[model samples]
Target chain A: MVKISDEEIRKMVIARLEITPSKRKIIIGGAGAFTKKELIEKIKQHDPIGQKIIEVHLNYLRSFKKQQFWG
Target chain B: MIITRPNHDFATKYLFRWSQTVITLAKKRNILVIDLKGKRASRVELTKSVRKNTADFIFINGHGNDDLVTGYNNQILVQFNDNEKLFRGRIVYARSCRSAAKLGKSCVKKGTRAYLGYTDDFIFYSDAASKFLGPSNLIAKTLLIGETAGQADQKAKDAYARTIQRFENSSVSEKDRELIPYLQWNMEKQVCLGNKNARLKI
Candidate 1:
């Protein structure tokens, strides 16, 4: 099995979105909805890559709804 | 042209206007416009119409998040099912905010060449609508002719910048000018592209 790092998962997400690192980092870190653990689990189940991308996006949704967790 | 509007009054108006402008511009370039409206169409309908008709590019204008596009009555619009592979080889320009984030994996998995969308909440300013039309048209044209995602993005950004420049040059009233900067800032902030080289066409 190929081991994928959290950072690699992050990069894969960014690459898929066609966004730069600067933009990707901001969306993933500051958005605040995604927990690192939950994302890793989702990645493990649904994707070849890991879960960093989902984590960042969870944050984005949280920020958008102004909610603390996934709605 | 597949325009899906949930219940947002403002977004519906903006999409209507944008669709009108796109159709007019496309006509000038001799491009045919296929109108796909309403929320009842299934994924099969979308794929068959697009593939059989051979649309060069597909534009999905609707309210979307990172995961899915919602239809009227909170119906989720998805391009693929467990056994079906759709949305292949098309450049999808999603007007919904933040719809492009983390959606790349799904798009890639479905075999779509690339996806473009906002990374944050977007305010549909009137001037921004006019400004976005040209760039959007150019991007569609390039994609239809087989330009790579990266090339299409550059062309689209250049068009967006030109639109900003024109907005600055226009002699609008002071009230509008003050709002223009805010609108411009939002436009700059929200615009994002993903998967520059994702080649979906087989």
Candidate 2:
């Protein structure tokens, strides 16, 4: 299977939404209400590639939030 | 360099030129050329060939809609029909426009590391520009030579930009200049929807 990385998700989401990085952060933060696994399931319902990508983006967002709080 | 250019005569001319370039490049890199144009090969046939030969990279050039590429008959659609087992590891460059949309997710599910194409209805002009820019050939060369998808894509973009620069340098009418910008804009809007550095693992 194709391993979708965080950078790939970032580029795909940015291109799909035609938004900037700040806007991506906002949309991802809103979407991050669910866990990485849950987001993957939801995204898979639409597109498998999208599912893998969303999982990567969710992981990034989760870690970013954690880092923001801890560091 | 397997190719399939159907009824469109203008597109066929462009495809032939592009195929020659790819074949020459592949020869230089010691890659075999599996030419399949005008053979009326169906998706099933192509799938079988893909299964038989584990190609490092696959490049398809033809007319396409959001769902599939047009085969000889309008009733048939030429696409990568291999299940996860057949094409467990490969990178694909879909020269057909809109073949990389959400509908192409199955390609990745079937184990393609990267699939590059347009996200929307790309026009014939943009298709012509892509040919002139050699995005398909560039992608093939990069993948076969062990470069990342992003690297290949960047090279393709640079090639395209260089073409635009050449057009800008040439003496052209105002109307043509206006059209050139539109073409560049459309090309920029084309999105690559896969992991740039990811390699398919069978």
Candidate 3:
């Protein structure tokens, strides 16, 4: 499967969280210290923590669908 | 007991605010609190504090990975590679990322009585427009009220379940439902290793 674009990933995360970047707080793995836009930009850079942040949200996404994860 | 509270950013500050009640409860029980706040929350200060006391409990709240727990300015307060020696004979509970993945086992190997923490990121959410304490109240109350480590771990899991259920039943937006998976993930990943029945010597 082709990987989603960073923009799409950001939108998916924001839609999943239902929080705007301007006034909300989001805590993730590597970019836990960054805000919405900052976190998106950080993740876009493919940093290690940023990758983990994306992977965590993806894990949640998958688990919410299959109702189970790495057991 | 030592609590590493670093409020240098938004998420840390949010967690720090949520933990005010737990801090008060521990103080009420006369637990020795080596609070690492602001600039004092550095590796040097943490090492000194841990070395200076025969403290039985270590509770850290910050960002971390499988090998370490960070502090103010993301300084490594405890890392498995370098700081495993400091946690011997202690019960460690890290509310950070993945410290339990490797650091917890390292502490157990280094002779800790028990280590309780999340194998994944300890995720949380809040109403940006309102205040929500999340599970900190119940989890901390149960875990710090002199219960066995195993019991405390179970209580925390139960609290997580109840909180998730509450979120499901609430009339929040659909996107908010995504938060449930994270809560469930945290509940399932939070683990206890070594002595299950250990208790803090507070």
Candidate 4:
């Protein structure tokens, strides 16, 4: 396994989230919904929601790595 | 059937509206529904309703964490080691974030027949809330239609898989395709605790 710094992972997650449309809003539990721009700012701020988004992205990547998709 | 719909913030508002479909289905199935909507979704009301309707299947829609599920304005409704015992002998499907991690387990330990919920934060997109909710609602809808808790859990996951598959298609718009990750997250996090064979009595 390749060792990546936490900063690198955060950057990767933020970059991936950047491609999402600006109008799109994702609801993350009680923190409510956030647009891509807001999420990016949160990521930069390293708030709980930002960390959550990072975790979510990492989890999705792991699923992709395991080929968990039906296809 | 007792369902709580807390329409306070954006997240709860979406859940509140989307969960109406399950209520409608319950009524159509001739199941009596005790709806705790808005301020009525408080812990007091939920406790009273549960005590009164001991066998009512509970469908909770709100924000939550590993040890507790909330209602309107984030009021704590059920919590681990607090009032989870109230769910004993009843089936509960909590469409809230992370409650299954601790609260659901506590409920099961306290004798809840079956508890279905997410082990992680339950997420969805605002533009496609209804589509996401369609699968989420299946837990309660399937139960109301006489499926066991385990079967309802599988049916909901299958619905999520079908939705994700549809979005994975090349013909689908990129905007819609963006929803697949969140869909997969919810599907993977959803869990059925206690007796998988437990069926609703009401």
User: TM-scores, in order shown?
Assistant: 0.55, 0.60, 0.78, 0.95
Superior by TM-score: candidate 3 or candidate 4: 4
Q: Write the per-residue lDDT of candidate 2 for residues B60-156, one digit (tens) a residue.
A: 6665656666543332344445243343466766666566775356677766677776654433232233534365467656766667877877776
Q: Which candidate number has the best TM-score?
A: 4
* Candidate 4: residue pairs that collide: none
What does chain B score (TM) in every candidate? Answer: 0.69, 0.76, 0.89, 0.97
Candidate 4 segments exceeding 4 Å error = none
Report residue B63 deviation for candidate 4 (angstroms): 1.4
Residue-pair clashes per candidate, as listed?
A: 5, 0, 0, 0
DockQ (CA atoms), all models: 0.02, 0.02, 0.27, 0.73
- TM-score for the first chain of model 4? 0.86
Which pairs of residues collide in candidate 1? A17-B194, A18-B194, A18-B195, A33-A59, B89-B200
Worst 10 residues of 2 chain B by lDDT: B122-131
Off-target runs (Cα >4 Å) in candidate 2 are A1-71, B1-8, B73-87, B124-136, B165-176, B198-202
List model 2 lDDT by residue over A1-71, tens digit each. 66767556655644432322221111121012223344344454655434434443354345445652210
Candidate 4 residue-pair clash tally: 0
lDDT of 3 by residue, A1-71 (tens): 88888779866765544454354555654355445566566566867655655666776667666865222
Worst 10 residues of 3 chain B by lDDT: B128-137
The digit string of per-residue lDDT tens for model 3 on B94-123 reads 778788899989989889888888787765
lDDT at B39 for candidate 2? Answer: 48
**Global CA lDDT computed for model 2:** 0.52
Give the winner by lDDT: 4
Interface RMSD of 4: 1.4
